[model samples]
Target: MTQRPVSNPAPANNPAPAYNPALSGNPQSATGRAYPNGNPDLGYNPPGVRNTDSAVPLRRDKPVIHNYACKDAAPGNLAFRWTYGSNVAAKNRDPRVQVVQYNEDSFVLRQNVCVHWEAPFTYLLFGNKGALLIDSGATADAQHYPLRATVDAIITRWAQARGRRAVPLTIALTSGEDVAQNQGLVQFAGRPETTIVPKPLHVMKRFYGLANWPSGTGAIDLGDRVIEVIPTPGTHQDGVSFYDPYCDFLFTGDLLFPGKINIGNDRDFVASLERLKAFAADRPVKWLLGGHIEMMFVPGKYYPRFATYKPYERVLEMLPAVIDEAIQYARDVQGKDMMLIRPDFALFNGVSPDQRTQVWPVGVPNINAPRPF
Candidate 1:
């Protein structure tokens, strides 16, 4: 689905709003100002911004951007969602660009670019045996700062980190949402020699057809690390999950998030979550890497605010609830009802009524059980 660009509406006739210096730098003040605990107006403050005094300087050698926009329909509901908090630190603390380290075998490196906003995308360089990248940012408009430069820098840095040698890099998709994979391929295309593994057929056929695309589920075995692609349908037919056995990490593209799951594609969303749960049950998923949020699943903790139910032995634990929610929503409201009640169905209005009828099982009479996947 093509995302409509958020046109920066011209400033209102009223005098320009005063710049909150707190919003810019002061960590404590910014935290309070952005999220005043129980206040409805204050949204979620991005991670690292809450404690600014301890803010680590961004790696200067690389460009970075941070965004803090809430994912829910209600702008104020910031908790458990991902958002941009502050710009990247000016200095390079570690040139290695390790965003999060799961264990001795695995580590994640994040690229710096774009300030916080809707649909923020970050590049993750995963190192197992060889190197693999999860999701590329949207690069439709060259005018947009950092989006282009940020991705380019990451590609360069990733190569350099690998000693600029000819290393095979595989691109994995969480969802084919433009932000996650669009610009990512464009940037990688610049490096002709680098081995680019195409996403699996199940995902690609649904969102983007085989137009100027590569073939097969490109698997890379980098000695100690092995990256394999698994199809995760539901959120988007093209959605995929990456499993790194060396690190025991599962990059759940967009199947899950810290807070609410974006089951915009309801049926697949539930199924995708179920798939992840089943995988987690058998494997050691120490880290649930999210394309959007900094952390989605932290072991042994109930992230109720993010709609995470307990006893999360597998991805299925969250599925029944999400399916129930979507099914209930379809039953509760009129197909034409518009107050934008649910996030999953918000985009429903954007599509044709016929499409809505096809997608939503809600309001349909005698729909006994939830729609089967």
Candidate 2:
């Protein structure tokens, strides 16, 4: 018993062990502790201590949650002044690509009329892992259009804002045959960390996961953001439309816009419009964005072809009611070869190639004089 009571003391040259609240189970003093409020490394505070730093909260007081499963769509802004290019390319100083930030994760880009007469609109959407570019504009030369450069800058800025290193891009087109929309595809070639969907019917079907060519829908998963790809091949055989649930935007491309609807297949055009109407019946569609806006503010009036200047251009965002109206108009002129001009859109069903050169006013026949039969 007397031997057990005797204990050896630490050497005089030895230093004292460091104090750790986690290991030692001791309360840290305010002055000697590295963190004045509490141990920063600890997940929870000691019995009597309060966590002063908000970074590690005691409990979730007001937690914010986003229920993506809900069918309701998120609202966004559409109030923007689009850059309508000048009549003369030499005098036009507008940016080749006009980008409008609809929301935090979505951008609406438009090519200047000076760059291409069509001045098509493109959509860029971001998700957790990557981004999706809906359509390429009408310009191929990046030196003149700067599409790739503009997209690169946007992706870079988005990644930096989200503390990410890289964001992969996927380029898709509404219609592979549309020269006004796919001319800029060449700019994205050979780009690093990019995937361009081949402009072919079979390839697009596989790329978008559409088992049925012109009936069944497909999907493009941009991580958390899933875009519904509907088979809309009325204006063109390879044409497809995209529906974004987040923004509730139905991107109809050239199928339906505030411009001329040149119907490639009359039956398919009507069927596609009916499908769109049914699809939008239950779902809340905020807007039906299209490839281009050729209509003017005046009812059934559009800017002259190849006219770069459009001062009185109509609003680009079309309502879902336009789908019903379009379906009716398309069915009325199902087999006709004349242009049916409406207040919002002009239906060019079976119109001849030469008819495109002539401007048709808002009327049933859409012709000013009798044709030389």
Candidate 3:
């Protein structure tokens, strides 16, 4: 009567079975009638209802080539200021060594002028295998300069940054005879995993594989990076120059600096300049970095020897064209022993090696007073 003859009647407490499109294998229809909404449990998309969401196509299945090899020498910048010396009275505030990162893999460190008036610049270049330190600096006392410890810390930090436990250090010099450069060599003595190239002329030449020194070239491979060593014996008998193809930088040490150039052998000096000029002619030379800066910003002017506070000191970098000027100057003063003043650098031929143009009344800069420009 009410249900027009019920085929199957459920108990009062029992519920009827729900419709399932999945069991019937037809998501759109339940038994016979079509369903308005697609069955989510059956993983069915509604007909004529395209998904509006944007999608990216699947990438092609292929073996990806991962590059683990080291890259080529990348260019870096040197546009930052250096740490010049301050008054001796306030020397406590100055750092023993001023380290400037030219790039992630290269660093330039300078000795504080107050620690030693020379304030020579040292270079630290990193390679995958090891590291190369160009110069130790002017001071021998670790308490004063701390060259070895500073270098070690730098190496440790560099290694840690690359997920390494330790990295070896190779210490080389531009001129082993120059006290201002080799004085700190003693500090690196007995350092583990550190190779200090012998400061002696013959030994250093042999270490770099410069059998035909003063003529042939040598190389130091720091894994991927290579440092070219050129025999430059004019500034000193053991004088050498470093050329970094990566940076296009020629580190001339005392051979060609912004300050006084004391020529140990005028003949050797001249020949070396010619060689450097020729080398720079074919290659791209960005800057010629030297060990020290003695000249002021003014052309043909330099601070006296042992002068500590140099506020108006000239920049440390020199151009390759200066090599041309250096050749001309060397030629003009070839046979003479005199001081030649120029804008970029001063030449001292046949003079005292430690001689300076400016004469200090007290033989040292008066740190209490302002430096005379």
Best by lDDT: 2
lDDT of 2 at 326: 95
Q: For residues 211-325, write the lDDT of model 3, one tens digit per residue.
A: 8878888988887678888899987888889988777789999999998898878889999999998888877788999999988876666788877788888889998899998
Clashes counted in candidate 1 amount to 27
Q: Candidate 3, clashing residue pairs? A: none
List the candidates' TM-scores in order. Answer: 0.45, 0.77, 0.75
CA lDDT of every candidate: 0.40, 0.78, 0.76
The TM-score obtained by model 1 is 0.45
lDDT of 2 by residue, 326-367 (tens): 998899889878787788988887775325534554453442
lDDT (tens digit, per residue) of candidate 1 on 152-221: 4554554453334444555555656535445546555665445544455544543333342222233445
* TM-score of model 2 vs. true structure: 0.77
- Model 3 Cα displacement at 221 (Å)? 0.4
Task: Supply candidate 3's per-residue lDDT for 177.
Answer: 85
Candidate 3 segments whose C-alpha is farther than 4 A from its true place: 1-73, 89-92, 353-373
Worst 10 residues of 1 by lDDT: 72-81
What's the true lDDT of residue 43 in model 1?
21
Cα RMSD of all models vs. native, in order, equals 18.5, 14.3, 18.5
> Which one wins by lDDT: 1 or 2?
2
RMSD of 3: 18.5
Q: Which stretches of model 1 miss by more than 4 angstroms?
A: 1-83, 86-116, 119-129, 140-164, 199-219, 294-373
